[model samples]
Target: MSLLQTLPSLPSDAAYDLVVIGAGGAGLSAALHAAIDGAKVLVVERTAHVGGTTAWSAGTTWIPCTRHAKGVADEDSLERAARYLDRVVGDHADAALRRAFLAHGAEAVERFEQHSDVHYRPYALHPDYESDVDGSTLRGRALEPLPFDGRQLGALFGLLRPPIPEFTVLGGMMVDRTDINHLLSMGRSWPSLRHAVKIVARHAHDRLRHPRGTRLVMGNALVARLLHSLAQRPRVTLLMDTQMREIHVSDGHPGPGRSIEAVTLESAGTSRRIAVRGGLALASGGINRDPVWRERHLPGIPMDWCPGAPGHTGQAQALALQIGARHGQGAASPTFWAPVSRRQRADGSTAVFPHFVMDRAKPGMLTVNQAGRRYLNESMSYHRYGLAMQAEQCRSEAGEPGAAAALPSWIVCDAAALKRHGLGMVRPGGGGLAPFIADGYLRHGATLADLAHQLGMDAATLEATVATHNRHAEAGHDPDFQRGVTAYQRNIGDATWPGRNPNLGALTAGPYYAVQVVPGDIGAAVGLQTDDQARVLDAQGMPIGGLYAVGNDAQSIMGGTYPGPGITIGPGMVFGFLAARDAWRRCRSA
Candidate 1:
């Protein structure tokens, strides 16, 4: 059934204790938490589907010291995590907010696991991105959502925003890092073969009656669990295809007297004014979709480069600003980024695939600027790699030496690496190279000089870069940028590789291949300023009553720095939980 069919008509004058705008992970979490807390809640989603960009992500949550990480890393503690954050984040964000997240994050996770369908398990080997940072650990901080049986939602599964087709396999079967490993090793290992056969068979069965595979993992599982939990709450109403047209405050001006009073919502071309009793939680994906915010904050980036969902139009921020909500400052960057490659699919849609850990850092692979020169340590986190791209682009624009053309960098790799790790949209084993080449997505050449010509780079410079890299790679070292020295970097590299350094290998084999990568903002970091309790704040740092912001809608507590996996989703969920509980407390006092 469609989302509209599942939803009953709500009266124009209907009142709710809390109205959450945007149904991403944070919004859904807020609604679920509030409803569970005995407050009448209404969730408004701009699109027909729930789960914003979170559905497109890997769904790892980085919360230190949770019960899930208890036995895995007994040394982990709130104090240590705080110290790590203090060193990495510094004064980029409010210290109080960071402290609050650390203090209450475990409580929030405990609440959801006990009171709702949400569950998490710690990753045994997931390390903090800055492995060298003080108090960093090799495991137990990152949590992965348990795979969900979408069949539990039955027909409502259709309402969940489908995972990116490029991220799935066997047509529509969703797979995670573990699944990919199993699929890759199925040819040699009985256990892997069994796993692959079981998943493939399940997907085959699912296709008979469903639009996509029903065994959900990663972000889809997290959203599905939240949806199921919300469905069980009778006091919660979910409205899709709903737009918040306006927000009215208690007073006409921005001041201590100001508080969210009512909101105008439009659905199916009909506008209705509904009173709000407690607060409005803004969980819109971010300002990436809003032209004004995009231009003001992320000046030169194209909208097509952003991989987030379309629901984050900065509409909620604009509405809050009308009553004095101000954006936060002092962040390292305005957005979180990932280096992404684009490919045109047969369905006429462009697949903007994020090059996170698949190929860039693996042995026998390297990224270079248009000048055919290496610029950064290829084994760094995707966020830092993207920042490096931006830095290179800025240098090129500023006429820096040998950096004149660096915007759309290239990831060059040999046939051996391409067959093993794959290049953007192209699956491993190099099975279908013809289509990718014909579509101008993957560029290939018989040699370094030939590839340089194909990529419009200087032939001699390309050959020199490769020769120098090979000399170091043969010695199992990266002198220029120190690639793969850290635990985090090695973790992303090919651990099965026999090379002394998992990230270092000579790109000697031909035919060599290259894919174009551009900096893509995966999510926004600069957003509405809020206090520790998740209440939106004004220019004076005073809380705006009856208003809250979570997810990308709120200023990231990490100060725009990517600390570890699931930094975005983790804080979004923790603050969403906090916002709902705070609103409920306010409602009870009223």
Candidate 2:
């Protein structure tokens, strides 16, 4: 008899046309595409929720050559986008991979809007990090979600991760920076007052019904909208609290040929195997959150800024490795680092940074060590900011030898600084600044000398740095460091200042305060290497069949540098679409 006849038949319910591991933005997009194409799809997410980090993100997706740019004043071309990528990523990226992303990104973005409930509105205000680069337009390519109603999710609202409340969000509130500015400008105008009245009326109506007050904008609006769309699709089924343990491979011929047949997972305390007939797509995110991995790779720095779900470990990466999937060069994994303001939560938990600090209207101030020296430019991009924090950690380790050097750095500022820039010092719920001051996270003193002494810094040096900075503020020039050199820094700088360079201001006032700064990361950007088609490559540089990776799990196509805002999410959606399309083609050909 045949081998099939001898073997016991597998359960009828265990099989599917496509098995997608992880249900974040990338996985969700891939599954939606494949399912719409008539393939039976299964999405397994380790977390109980489906939104992943995308829920916590800014929700602005940067896409070049998009239709949203048609009537826009600024003009951009695909060739220019390609050149910018080439210049920024240089020799690190595969040329074929870059070409594939550029060719398909626009098509994928447009197609998703047409087929799904996702609304793609042109973010005319967003800018590329390097506008000097050719093809880089100030606005046009970026797209954001239109304001979505979370009430539609009903009981599923809790399953959706809420946006950072510190930043405003309102249901049915779809807006970009320009929209917000217009709102603020209108507050000063008759039209704005009327708009505000309308908003208040809507909010009052929402408050009586929902626990979380209504107006929605930014990342929260995007996730709620997408999940609402996915919920309506009969082909898409969300399996939460399900973790894949291993890849079930089918042995072929005599040689070492094998194919991924299914994924064995543990859910609800029981083991089950989900077989894949069409293909398997891995969008399970990166390995940044694994303390063991971070300790092994990035030894000195503190791991603070991960926006991914706690379940976003390297299960998918381990599975890929088991199947002989090869990783890329130049740091086996990418280091995630960001400057975080040290704040205490209402329940005495440590508050993360950027969410609390990176605002120009409300600056978190400069973070210094025990030596009273500023370690990094507070306004550097998140990627570079993390590198700077790591460098500081390295220097501390090198200096101390065996003793554990402190990881927390002090955010030095004065009362006048607080008055000029909203420091976000007051926590909600009428707490007496005790949350920040009690833990030594925020140190206050009447004089600079006292503050330096309290922070264990060289009083003379600290005083000199402040004095020098103050002199520059009076002169309307920054001699030591050009604080206002970049638009990002200036954007968050004190706008009320009369000087041309608003970011530079003298922190010369009594009752100085110092808050500790720590290392935080947005998410890991390192994973398995792939070519233009988003195909996973093995140790010998050959494609692994029935396997693909995208988003943060795939080695970044932009290399180490962040080229623009929403760079991570933009490429993620593009490659996700590419992976699904390629897999569909392969399955059809077979």
TM-score winner: 1
- CA RMSD of each candidate after superposition: 1.5, 5.4
**In candidate 1, which residue pairs clash?**
none
lDDT of 1 by residue, 1-590 (tens): 12232223676478889999999998988888898798899889989899999988998988888998888999989999999999999999999999999998999899999999999999879989998999888899899999999999976788899999999998899999999999999999999999999999999999998889999999999999999988887788888888899988886567886888888888887788878899999998889898887888877788888888877889889988988999999999999999999987788878899999999999889999998999999988888999998898898989877775667999999999999999988899989899999989999999989999999989999999999999988888899999989999999999899988999889988999999999999999999999999999998888888899999999999998988999988888889989998888888898
What is the lDDT for 85 in model 2?
Answer: 79
- Provide the lowest-lDDT 10-residue window in model 2: 1-10
How well does candidate 2 score on lDDT at residue 144?
A: 83
Clashes of 2: 14
- Measured by lDDT, the strongest candidate is 1
Model 2 regions more than 4 Å off: 1-11, 71-73, 131-135, 165-204, 252-257, 304-307, 331-333, 342-349, 355-357, 360-364, 395-406, 424-434, 494-497
User: Model 2, range 1-590, lDDT digits (tens) per residue?
Assistant: 11011011334466766777877777877877776576666777887676677776777787888888778724578888888878867776676777888898878877778887777788645566665566567677778878777777777676776554444435433333544444545646787667766766776787678656555566666667667766666655567777788887777221145667777877767777777776788888777777877787667545554534566677788878888887776632274455566555667755564532233223325556666666556655556656766667777878754222336666677775654443444332223555566766567788989888788877897887677766766675555545566654565565556665666666766788776556666667678898887788887777777788888788887776676777777788888888878777766886
| Residue 214 in model 1: lDDT | 95
